[model samples]
Target: MKTAIYEKAGKITVAEIEKPSLQAKDDVIIKVVRACVCGSDLWRYDENVPHEHGDANSGHEAIGIVEEVGEDITTLVPGDFVIVPFTHGCGHCDACRTGFDGTCDNHPGYQNFGNNYQSQYIRFHYGNWALVKVPGQPSDYSEGMIKSLLTLADVMPTGYHAARVADVKPGDKIVVIGDGAVGQCAVIAAKMRGASQIIMMSRHADRQQMALESGATAVVAERGEEGIAKVREILGGGADAALECVGTEASIDQALGVLHNGGRIGFVGVPHYSNHALGSTFSTNIIIGGGAASVTTYVKDFLLDAVLKGQINPGRVFTQTYSLDNIDQAYKDMANRKTIKAMVTVD
Candidate 1:
C-alpha cells in the first residue's frame, strides 16, 4: 500500500508500506476512496519536531469502502461504503451517547482507530458507531457528490460544530474569523442555522468569493482592529455571535473583537492561543464554547440530508484535486495558500 508520511518540518512524502489488517474484533479494513489534506495537517508540516511516522497517525479525514469487517461488527459488512470521521468512539460511552463522540471516554487519545487515511487502505477501529454508511459504492456518485460526502467526514461537521457551540440563532448576526476550509464551512453552517447576516473575515479574493458563495453576507479583508471595525461597520455594531475557525492568538482576538458585549463565541481551531488571550472575555458577558467536533453526531443528526439533497455545496471548498501519487504537491499548495483546500482521489 502507498501511505503519506510526515518526515519533518516542510516535508511530507508518499511511501510504500504494508497494508493494514484487522487487529481487533471490532476493527474494519477500509479501501480508501477519497481523502484530503486538512489545515491541521499543514500545522504538522510546519512543526520542527521529528514526525511520528507510522499507520497509527496519518491524514485524518476520509471516506472509503469497507473491504473487510470484524467479527464483532454486525451493523456493517464488506462492500459498505462509509465516511470515516477523524475521531472514533464506543457507541455506548457517555460521551458518544451525548453527541461528543470526539471525546469518547473508552477511546481516549489516539487509541481508537489508526487514522492513516491518506493511503490506499487503512484500519478503522470502534466500527459499530464511528463509521457513517453511505448509500452505495464510490462509482454510484459523481466526482463532485463524492467530494461533498468526504467533507462530512470532518470539515463540514467541524464547521457546523462551531455554529452549534456558539448557539447561532435565526436572525442573529455572526462573524467567522478564519477563511480556511473550516471557516468557509462555518459560513454555510451559520446560514443553515438561519442567521440573517453572515460576515466572513478573509483577505484573499478567492476565499472571499467562496465565502460569499457559501453564504457569507459580507467579507472583511482587513486583520486586527481594522478588520473588527470593518465587520462592526457592516453589521452596524458588534455581531451576536462570532465563530473562531483559526486557532491563533491573532485570530482568537479578531473573533473576540467583533462581538457584542453579551455575544457568544464558538471556536473549532486547533488551539494554538494561550489562556491570557481568552481572559479578556470575562469582563464582558461573552460565552466561549467548542472543541474537537463530534463528527458522527452532526452527520447522522442533520448535515447528511442537506448534502444528499443538494441543499448545500460544501465541497466547493475543495479548490484543487490530486492523485495519491501527487499528494506531496497537494500539501505544498495548501501550505502555500495556492489552494483553499486540496482533495485526493484514491479510487
Candidate 2:
C-alpha cells in the first residue's frame, strides 16, 4: 500500500505503507480508483503550514470501488463503485438531516479516513450513511465522466455550497472570488441555481476561459480594489450575492466589495483571515454564511443525477492528470498553477 507523505514544503514523497482495513463496525475499506490534489493541499506544500511532518494522508478527495464492507453497512457492498466525500456523518443526526453532514453530532469533524485518499486503499467511516453509490463500476464510465464524478467528492459540492448559502436566486447577479477549481465550480453552481449574471474574478487566461465555459457571464482579472471595481462595473452596481471561494483576507474583502449593502456572501474557503476582518459586515447589513460543504447531501439529492444526465461538466477543471507514483509532481503542478486541478489515477 503506497501513500503520499508530506516531508516538507515543495515535497510529497510516496512510500509503501500498511493498507487500511475496517477499524469499526460501520467502516468500509475502498480501493481507490481516481483521486486528485485539492487546492487546500497546497497550504502545507507551498506555505509550509505547521503540521506533523511525514503525514501519510495528504489528499482528501477520491472515488473508488468498495472492496470490503462492514457488518453494519447495508447500502453498499463489495465491488460497489462510490464517491467518497471528505466529510460525513450519521444520517439521522440533526445536522445530517439538515444537510450539514460536516457538523454531524455523532461523528463531529468527520472527514475521509486518515485523509490518506491518494493511495491504493482507505478506510471509510460511516459507510452505511455517507458513501454515494454510482450506477456502475468505474470502468462503466468514460474518462471524462470519471473525472466529473471525482469532483463531486469535494470541489463541485463545495462550490455549490457557496451558492447554496449565499441564496443565489433566479435573475440574481452574483460574483465569485477566487479562480481555482472551486471557483470554477461555483460558476456552474450559480448558473444551475438560476443566477442570471455570474462574474468570476480570475487573472489567468486559462482559468478565465474555464470559468466562461462553466457559465461565468463575465471575468475580472484584477485583484483587490481593481477586481472589485471591475465586478461592480460589469454588474452595473453591487451584485445580489457573492461567493468567496478563496479563504484569504484579500479574497474575502473582494467578495464583500462587489455586493450590495444588504447582499449575502457564501464563504467556503478555508479560513485564514483575522477574526475581526468579517466584523465590518455588521455595519453593512451583509449576511455571511457557509462552512464545510454538505457533500453527502448534495451528491445524493441532485448532483449525481445532474452529472449522470450530462447537464454540467464540472470535470473540465481537471486540466491535468498524474499517476499515483507521480503524486509529488501533481502537487507541484497545482502549487505552481500549471494545472487548474490535478487528477490522479491510482493503479
Candidate 3:
C-alpha cells in the first residue's frame, strides 16, 4: 500500500508500507479515493519538527469506498462510499446521536483516524464511527458533487460549525477572518445562515475571488488596524457576528475588534496563540463560541443537501489536485500558500 508519512517539518513523502487489516471487530478498510491537505497540517510544517523517518500518520480529510469491513460493521459494507469526517465518532453514542459528534465518547478523543488517509488504502477503526455513508452510490452524482462530498469530511462542516456556534441569523452583519478553505466555507456558511451582509477579510487575490463566488458580499484585503477600519467602515459600525477561522492572536483580536458590542463570534481555527483580547470579551457582551465541528453528525445540515442539489461549490476551494504519488507536492503547495487547498486522488 502507498501511504503518506509526516517524516518531518517541510517534508511529506510517499512510501510503500504494510496494508492495514482488521484489528477490531468493527474496523474497516477504505480504498481512499480522494484526500486533501488541511490548514492544521501546516502547524507541523511550520514548527519545523524533525519527525524521524516515517514517523506519523498525519492526514484525516478524505472520502472513499469501503474495501472491507468487520462482521460487526452493519452500517457499511464493501463497496459502500463514505465520507470520513476529520473528527471520527461513534455514531450511536449519546453525544453523536444528538449532534455533538466532536465530543463522541466511544472513540479516541480529538485525534484523527490513526493513519494518514492520503494513501492508497487505510484502515479506519470503528467503521461505523469513522464513515458517513454517502446518500447514494458514487456514480449517482456529477464529478463536482464528489469533490463537494470531500469537503464535508472537514472544512465545509467546520465552517458551518462556526456559524452555528455563533448563532448567526438573518439580516445580521457577518465578518469572516482568514481566507483559507474553512474561511471560504465560512462565507458560504454565513450566507446559508441567512446573514444579510457577509464580510470577508482576505489578502490573497485568488482566495478573494473564491470568497465572492461563495457569496461573500464584501472582501477586505487589508490587515491590522487598516483592515479592521476598512471592515468597520464597510459595516458602518460593527458586525453582528464574526468567524475567526485563523487561529492566531492577531486574527482573534481582529474578530473581536470588528463586532458590535453585543455581537457573536465563533472560531474554528486550531488555536496557534492565545486570543489576546480576554479583556474585550469580558467588557463587551460578545457571544463567543466555537470548537471542532461535528461534521460526522451535522453533514446533512451543511453539506448533503447543498451537494445533492448542486446549490453550492465547496469543492472550488480545492484549487488544485494531485495523484497520491505527488502527495509531497500537494502538502508543499498548500503549506507555501501557492494553493487555496490541495486535493489528492488516492486511487
Give one digit per residue, the lDDT tens place, for model 3 in 88-159.
Answer: 677778877877777677764655546578788878876676578887677787768888889998999999
lDDT of all predictions, in order shown?
0.88, 0.90, 0.84
How many steric overlaps are in each model, in order?
0, 0, 0
Q: Which stretches of candidate 1 lie over 4 Å from their true place?
A: 52-56, 111-113, 275-280
**Largest TM-score belongs to which candidate?**
2
On residues 1-347, what C-alpha lDDT tens digit does candidate 1 reach at each position? 99888766787778889888999998999999989999988877866767466522668899988999889998798989999888886878898888888778888875334678999998888888888998878788888898899999899999999999999999999999889999999999999999999998888999999999888998988899898889888999999999999999898888888998999999999789785555667888899988888888889887888999999899998989999889889989999999988999885
TM-score, candidate 3, is: 0.94
Clashes of 2: 0
Worst 10 residues of 3 by lDDT: 107-116
**Which parts of model 2 have CA positions greater than 4 angstroms off?**
275-279
Per-residue lDDT of 9-106 in model 2, one digit per residue for the tens? Answer: 88898888888888888999999999999998898789856667656577889999999998988999899999998987688988888888867878
Q: Give the higher-TM-score candidate: 2 or 3.
A: 2
